[model samples]
Target: MADGEEVTLDGRPLHLLRVADLKAALESRGLAKSGQKSALVKRLRGALMLENLQKHSTPHATFQPNSQIGEEMSQNSFIKQYLEKQQELLQQRLEREAREAAELEGAFGAKSGDFGNLSHLEGIWVKFRRIWVI
Candidate 1:
């Protein structure tokens, strides 16, 4: 089929599709792609028909309060809340780490330190080594 053309499950457009195009469409819909052109066409048609039926079908199941489903919904809500709390804790930890890093940088006089000077780096390394070694 041509690009930008509306794909129809109708017999004409489906029949016009090349084997490769048919296989591609089948593969896209997670349908079995290993088949002859005619078989592929039939499979695609069935899938499209089923999909159309599902879209048109009305809901058979209705939500009932104070049921097992309600308990499941509450459990899902609890999980969501727990995940949000974990995310908040993670954010706080990241902020703490950033603050500590900034304090370390300040102690090293990083903003004003002469990074181009080898002697300055050597002095900082010596201080770092002394603190760690002790």
Candidate 2:
């Protein structure tokens, strides 16, 4: 497998493991090992996905609180921070897109009235017609 490729729970690269290796890996995880090769691959992928979700979903020890109110407050703060960061990123992206659109319009001569004038359009049509005639 490639270096950037994802691995299984046992650190073995996915899509490169043989049938026996798959069975062994499933057995090690106490998962069902009885299935066809495709089924085995699907089961292993599902296990890997579930493991990743569980790892990411678990809160850090520092975030854990003894009191329920304290935990709720901490969670609320985290959520607010996350939302603000997302909104800032979105605003930056929108501004970048608007700048790019303006640049494209300038490059295509749209700001110089090249597209707004009928004479320029007729010149473009004449050039296009000449190209087809040749």
Clashes of each: 0, 0
* Model 1: CA > 4 A from native: 1-7, 10-12, 63-134
Per-residue lDDT for 1-134 in model 1, tens only? 33475346544577788888888889989989987888988888778767876988887588655567535644686765765565556556656655665686789867534334544544655564443331
* Candidate 2 backbone collisions, by pair: none
Which tens-of-lDDT digit does each residue in 25-100 have in candidate 2? 7898789999898888888887877777788786787774654664464468676576556555655665665566
**Global Cα lDDT for candidate 2:** 0.67
Model 2 lowest lDDT segment of ten: 112-121
Q: How good is model 2 by TM-score?
A: 0.36
In angstroms, the error of model 1 at 120 is 79
Q: What's the distance in Å from true for residue 91, model 2?
A: 60
